[model samples]
Target: MNKIEIIARRILGWKLNRWDRWYDFEKEQFIPVSEFQPEENIEHAMLIVERLKELGFSYKTNGTSGACFGDVCETGETLAQAITNAAYSVADNSSIDEGWL
Candidate 1:
């Protein structure tokens, strides 16, 4: 899986359902949440930020250099890349259910 997917399923504890999907306001169309790439879509990316907030963490990005969550900070060329990388920094991907362990 990709970085955003890993962050969603592993770090965010997302369990997929058949009905999993979302509406893209920007594109004005429906899309599968399972296929949502938060790094490329700002709205969906905000959802990740909100989820992180609910999880008792805060995020900050310079929009050009990097983003940070708690004590971990990661740098990237773009804001989206930076945020995604930072979020993925906390992912525990060694789970048997995810088939990576």
Candidate 2:
């Protein structure tokens, strides 16, 4: 496996599956949120957020009442796009190439 896949599988504990789904490490099987715990889902999401931060991404909240979101440093990008770019960076060991943000 490439470094990206290795890091994703070993550190993030995720495996891409068909139908836009991912394997849940805690569950030991491939399934959707409908079969998982809410807390686990939050934990997994936080993991990605943390990783993105490590890759120089930033996040903000609406003063504890607004929705939480992330953005690229010095750029306006959606949280989802930031996360995807960061993951690709980790996998490829290269800087983010997406220009959306």
Candidate 3:
């Protein structure tokens, strides 16, 4: 399977996902927005958000690195949701794409 890891753009508490066949992805409390430097300011974060948007992510904007969209994401929400949304946006392959987890 393809094991991939991308730094997060926001802080996430975590949740259990049992919809598809993908393995469980670890829950990270903090995720870096930029792929380059681990630390980031709002601008760098926005840049990461913009890149993520191009990759399939979306956001309304709240002057933050990552915007809240799905289910409010738990107070601060999750940075992974944006990418997950983008991934699912491509297609609903949850039932088959076991590697998505």
lDDT of each: 0.65, 0.45, 0.33
lDDT of 3: 0.33
Worst 10 residues of 2 by lDDT: 67-76
Runs of candidate 3 exceeding 4 Å displacement: 1-5, 8-40, 64-66, 69-101
What TM-scores do the predictions have?
A: 0.65, 0.35, 0.31
TM-score, candidate number 2: 0.35
Clashes of each: 0, 1, 2
Q: Per-residue lDDT tens digits of candidate 3, residues 10-88? A: 2221132332222223433333222323122344334444544554435563432334333222112333434333333
How many clashes show up in model 3? Answer: 2
Return the clash pairs for model 1, or none. Answer: none
Give a tens-digit lDDT track for model 1, residues 1-101: 66765776655555444457544443466567756776776666666677677776788777786888776788877676677777787564243244321
Candidate 2 runs further than 4 Å off:
1-11, 16-21, 32-45, 50-76, 94-101
* Cα lDDT over the full model 2: 0.45
Per-residue lDDT over 13-100 for candidate 2, one digit per residue giving the tens place of the 0 to 100 score: 6676754456866667775534422122434445655755565656554322222334322111444333434444444444545332
| lDDT value, residue 76 of candidate 2 | 14
RMSD to the true structure for each prediction, in A, is: 6.4, 8.7, 11.8
